[model samples]
Target: MNQERSTLPSIWSAAPPGGIDRSAFTGKKPNKIIPVPHEYRRQTLSRERDMLIHDVEQKTGCDLVPHWDQGKVTSFDIYGSGHGVEKATVYLNHWISNAHTKSIGASAWAKLPAYDPNKWYYAQVEELDNVYKQRFRGPVPSEGDADAPRHAAVVDWPEDIKNTSQEFVSPREVFGNKLERLDELRMQDKVYITLQQSNHDGHWYLEILGHDVVDVELAREHLTTMIQTVRADAAGVQDAHNTILDEREGMEVELQQCEPWWPNQADYVVPQLLSHAMMDKPGSFRQEGLHFKQHLSLQRSIKAALDDVRRRKGAYDFVVRLGCLALSSKTVSKGIIGRTVSKDSFSKQIHESVQLDVKKWLANNEIGCRILHRLMAVKGFLEPTKSGGYFGYTPETLKETRPIFRGTWVFKDPNSSVVATQTSYRHPGRPAPFQKPVEDAQAAPMSLFVIQIDWTDDEQGMYEKGTPTFYKLPPGATGPKKNMDISLLELGESRAWHFALESLIPVPRKTVSPVLVGFAERVRMKRNYDISSTESFAEWDTTLNIKKYLQTGRLDSIYSFGIEKTCYKVELTAMWYPSQQLPVWGLAVRHLEWASHLAELEDLPIGRQAMWLDTISSFLPDDGQSSSNIDEDSDDCGTRRLKVDDSDDESPRDGIRILTDKLMKLSEIVSSVTDCGGVQI
Candidate 1:
């Protein structure tokens, strides 16, 4: 049949015997089967096997290709015994591949009768050539690379390569079983290590070879969670610190604009008085002077806020330090491994970077804490003393009059009225004139005095006259002494009395004329007596006494008694009386004296002016009338009084009060920033 077909057409020949041009007559060109290079094929197959091994290791958490004593055994012969004959043939079975099956089928098809299963070897290979084309044939994974080593097992198989049981074995199941065996070996402490003795006689060198895969993964997860938590806490602290900074800046600007009066040596006394008043009746003082009390309350609140901020800052610092310690521990653990381990350098770099970040965070917290402390200190300096009614009058003091003095006098007869007098000259070895007979008397009798006492604050008896009385003198005294004791006590009450003494002085007598005995002798005697006389005539003017008493009281020499005459002594005491009327003229004169002392400033500063007006207003009868309508004119006392008109809301007093209130509100806002719920870590 072949001879007959060749003779007819020779269709299979490259060219037909006849010149028919069969190449052109063919319908399509036959595809060429290009031969793959051996090196390329090997590399491509190696990558495919590595990818498969990596997939199984990820699922099983085990090393499919384990390290051996001779070197990294990349083949299935884990013992590296070239014969490959072992009772435990499980690993050899797992190394079987399609290449072994193809080679066995080719030999079986060849009909070789003496084919040995032990001679058949396993080689890692893929059935589809497309798998080699799809994979990237890059450099093979190295021992230290994070990727799985690109290795494939080549083993001398002891079993038939065509066994269907080998095909049913899953790579993941085999690796999982191997991992369990590794765990068993680890638990039994069968994993061995190499120890080298150094050249020094007493020295021994040790090296850490590897770590448990499970333990390392667990540690990594734990550290990752801690890192995420630290990052969150850091973000929260940053936000809070920034908010505090902004509030503090705003408060600082407001504080700069406010020029509240600062306390001086003279002004410090008012704070002491106010503190005492507050201590005496804290609740009442706070209730009555709510506006004024805001200054102290805000100060305390700010201090407490500052303390809270400090505590939170400390906690934040501790957390930062703890994070730093954790990072350092991680770095130290990494350093325990060989320097050739790339993660050591990476971990050390991360630790250093975190340390710098921690330092910056702590520095920012410190600066914010310092600013809060400064704000607290500034708040401490704003005391409500100088401009708040001379220590800020309470409701009780505002309504009632404060008595300057009180006295009780015993009389021999109820109808008799006696006047105490001081003699001009006193006899030697006798009691001095004007001296009280009763040593235990409440107050000494005044020789010449003028007093202005509160009469009645009610509208019907607002101008009631003050009664002028005198203490009875001893029988032996005689002189031009004026008994002056003024009382605003109710009528028909004589034993006990309340009064405010305005002035007191001893009266002096005029010089007596010398009589002439003979014409020449009388002239000589008159001239000699006039030359020797040291006493001078002095008039008793209550106005001058009141002025001298207001300015310097007993401190002035003009109101002082001479050494030969005894002076009247008075003991004054302060008492609260709901019915007692305020001495308006006396207060006015005292205010005038206070103003005169500040004459160098020309006019009181706005702060002092407010204080002065507030003090004067407190004494008023709460009728809303200004000082001008108070009727403080005292023609008898002859002292200048303050007559301030109610300048309405334009007054400095009201303006200062408003400004102070605004400042206190601002302080409250500034302190609110420190109210963090608690420390965050």
Candidate 2:
């Protein structure tokens, strides 16, 4: 009952001086959280897992071990589209379809096919060995021999490999299904409530969007059937999207930081090397990450699906209030969040660079003609009967679509420094280079200016509606003031990271690399800043707590601390190459923002004050951690009690940072989860 039912006024505005009117209550009504039982939740996840797997296999024609390739091949590698590389080979002694028979000369041999577009046709290479070598010594048969003793005609496909897990269920297709359900949820309701979404759909379903739910139980008996059906019933799908966020820099969620210190050193040597290190790490996240904004927008849009009921809660603000404000007191354990790995981020970046080109090369290039034909076989378009390969859409459903927004970008040189040196473009008197036009000598030679928004993301993503303008051109695009003068190191290219860091990176960036920003710098905020930022001390304290929770996977990990006892280093390397930087800074900010929001709700009146109880009577730590307390009659249509945990360990997690050089501060600081066990991959 203490949960605030009244709507929080919209914080964004399209007009000047006075941004969106904050005084008027204009957002959607909040949802009521009705807690369900654990068994019910588990069963529902189980059932959905089974059904979805069957559905995907049926639609794709991958039902049996024989339907695919007559069992000739066991496992094959799939490259591109996030699939890494693997090797392959073909057995020539297999069944021949021709009727003629001819003997092969001693020099005759079989040639293996080369790489195909977007697909790895085989798994290994026997590379036709020296003609008579024992391993290559098979009864030599003619190409036209229809009855050559074939390699085992009934070869079995290994269902155990990662690529073949689709025989169990398709991850790509499941992601498609999750998106579809999200689309449905977005349309049905006018005003979406994080509390309601979490309770009804389960945190696994909402974790990608960053919502950590706290349940208020209604009744025990009603929960019996509710648990088995509610979660699966409302979500329409399970959130099994394990596609790793390809933006790892300093995103390991580790409890350490690394960088050279001392301000005197910032100006002297080649700063680009330091920037290169940052680039090798995670760069600005929220803005440029793959689909960061899409997940966020999906959550926000869930309220009305962009229909009649309007919501002014940009992704960041709502999470701050929801995680930081609404669910401040509790931890969400049933939640299914994502995993963030440095390798995934690094690989993603690497693949994206050439994945497209590789696909084209394998398709249009003359060398690619045969390779392209091989792809259609497994793709279900296997018609050696036709000339132009045509593997049409499987189980053709409605084409998936989401909202889009107009946006701009500036940074291009991955070598630019995140640290402010005497010669840096952002150093005091120097004009902000990112703010300049591409033609300006000060600007990045390959600077990007326009792009679209992925409205379904949730990594603190933001987007503007009007035609985007450039470098500090005043009378802001949607409001009276310009969007810059933000004190953090330039996102250089990622507005997504800036918005995400509006709540996450600084403390952690400073935590590892101390010399980046000054102590005094962290303390100041301009009166008219577009993004609502917290003081360094608040951010610092919150970040430290977040670090502990991530490592321990415990809700009790969050405890208040004194700013004086803490040490901070302003990480100025946010401008480092995004790949290297994302795992470090990007992930730190992401975790911090997510946990801080939930911790926000734990404390009332102010974030600084927090109360922790030793044990929760009602929850009872069923899985391993401590649980919540509940009273009798608590289930009398009153509210059920629920706590959301961090996302299950297998989910994908990524990060980004936008720290700038600044001096400052007294501060304190420090940060997988499983979704459902036996969850079909």
Candidate 3:
């Protein structure tokens, strides 16, 4: 296969200073592609990206830190995304230092409005390295030199230093071709950790690839002092937090006594030197057990190595710091394309941080949800519209006009039932696909969009869209009405529950009408199943609408042959249409077009996996079943009794009862969590 066709081509952004030439990604013959103008090389981002990056840094203290040292001739790419998730993260990199296999370089980033020190420092460090490489090392070869860190680039005595080395060499002899014969510099048996505190004070490990006896004594003292500094700071911060909590009760006592507390104060601890030099090689020790064992072992090795140096070379009595963590991961592999550290390794720190952030985000959202439930006055689902300006539609009646909608509002009441309190870019439910709309630059998010629904009346009263709200199926009419008489559906149409479909739920093949299923299967299994050409398409034009059955009141059935492995859990709201006297199967299926998050369902822990079950229990206002419970003309979704045989648990009501019991247990867990929140931890 041609290489270009075999792989996804890189997308090019806005054009650069030069007019467009041969596209870098286009698969022209090698003979035709090479020796082209340099302007045509390298991918770039749109101008908007540069502006956004600048705006983010200026408005929010966050910075984007990328990996350095692997300088290939490529343009900068500021934005990246896959699926729906953005790829802005902080990670660690394991690099080759001197002759050691791995040297750790941790990189981190913060989004705007959170000027994280680690992230800012990481970016600044990379920037300095980039400048030095561009100036001293010179522009990369047009085609690019992948074999990097030229012997000359490594000769910088300041950052690349053994300080004790007696050997000396000039950059000219290395890169300038001054030497008649070339020689590769090699480092000797030694290990060193260089902490870059600042540009002027930072230390380096080597002048070239050559190794030498390291100054273990100085290194040990530095390591011990830095660890002590970090540990002390952490302890101090914890102490301050404890002191603040202790005084909270004092405020109550003081209020009783009409007294005032003293001023609050605490020292801010600067972040540790995450950007440092440490061996990146895999830990020489491994035991087939949990991580705590490996963590303890790494600390032991550090301490043991320190003791060995002290015994032989009289280094400081440096104790290894346990319970401390640092980030380091390999970001590239042996391939032409860039490789990265295993996601698990690189994302460990970020994962912890994200979990904490997400928990806080969720907790706040829970509060928001409560406030919204009180404001909206209804508990059914409300999906955001595609437009950026937040709009929510809650169906009132089949008549489109009666549908309740919340729209624009301002500081004061805008005469609408729903009120908008605040407008912000960040929304709590933004993570969900239903609410994650294409962001509108012009729209400011409201603090709260009040539903202003007349829930009391809607719940108790019948839908007011059409008259004759009773079940008198027009005496002698074979059919209720014409197919398009949508308003012919009578009262109790609103007594519906939004059901979240489960993959594990048993769906009988009989749930779907045999005729429809047979036709679908036959059409799908045909030798040329899909119609491509206009001529071929004409042969089965009947297949187009796929909804011809809705007219005959025969559209009384639904089928679930199997779960769509790729799609998310299907959610359907079932209603009893008294005119047709059953759900319009096609109408219920129409809900599938609306976007919803599958990840949300998957994210629930297994113990709390019955979220849908809970929704079903709380959401159902009524399930219209007659005395006979016989569907003479079966049309409703639940026409027949469905059995769930879990250990011979055959009854549907029993299954629901069991699920409800579990829901109560989970509710208690939630209460416990809320109670724990008030107590300081």
TM-score each candidate. 0.12, 0.15, 0.15
lDDT of 2: 0.20
Question: How many angstroms is residue 586 displaced in model 2 relative to the true structure, after the best TM-score fit?
Answer: 29
The TM-score, computed over Cα atoms with residue i paired to residue i, of candidate 3 is 0.15
Per-residue C-alpha lDDT of model 1 across residues 1-681, encoded as one tens digit per residue: 987877663323332112112233123211111111111122113333344334333333332321111121222211111112121122222323122334322322212257655544321233233233222222233468565333222211111212233442222232242223223222222121222344666333221122344533332333233233333333332111100101111111100110112111111111001112223331122122224343333223322222222211110100001000011232233333222222233324433442111111111222233323333333423221111122212122111221122111112111111322213244578564322232222322322221212221122212222232222223223221211111111001000011111112211111000000011121111111221122211112233212332211110001000111111111111121222221100000011122222232232211121223322232221222223333345462311224333223222233223323332332232223344411111
Candidate 1 vs candidate 3, lDDT winner: 1
Q: Could you arrange the candidates by lDDT from highest to lowest?
A: 1, 3, 2
User: CA lDDT, every prediction?
Assistant: 0.22, 0.20, 0.21
Better of 1 and 2 by TM-score: 2
Candidate 1 structure lDDT: 0.22
Model 2 segments beyond 4 Å from truth?
A: 1-515, 519-639, 643-681
Q: lDDT of model 2 at residue 216?
A: 12
Candidate 3 local lDDT, 429-453, one digit each (tens): 5542111122222322221111111
Q: What is the C-alpha lDDT profile of model 2 across 1-681, one tens digit per residue? A: 334533433333111122122123122111110111111121112222233223323333222110012212211111111101100001111111110132222112222357684354232232223211221122324446653323211111122323222343222233353333222222221111121123564322221111111111111112222222322223332221112222333333211111232111212111010123444443333234335454433222221211110111121211100000000012221121232234434235323431100000001112122222222222221111111011111211111111121122221211121211112123467544221111312322231111111111122322222221222111112211111111111111111112121111011111111111111123222233322111111111223322322111000001111111111111101111111211111111111122323333222221011222211111112221113323454453313223222222122111111111001010001000112211010
Give me candidate 2's TM-score against the actual structure: 0.15
Stretch of 10 with least lDDT, candidate 3: 485-494
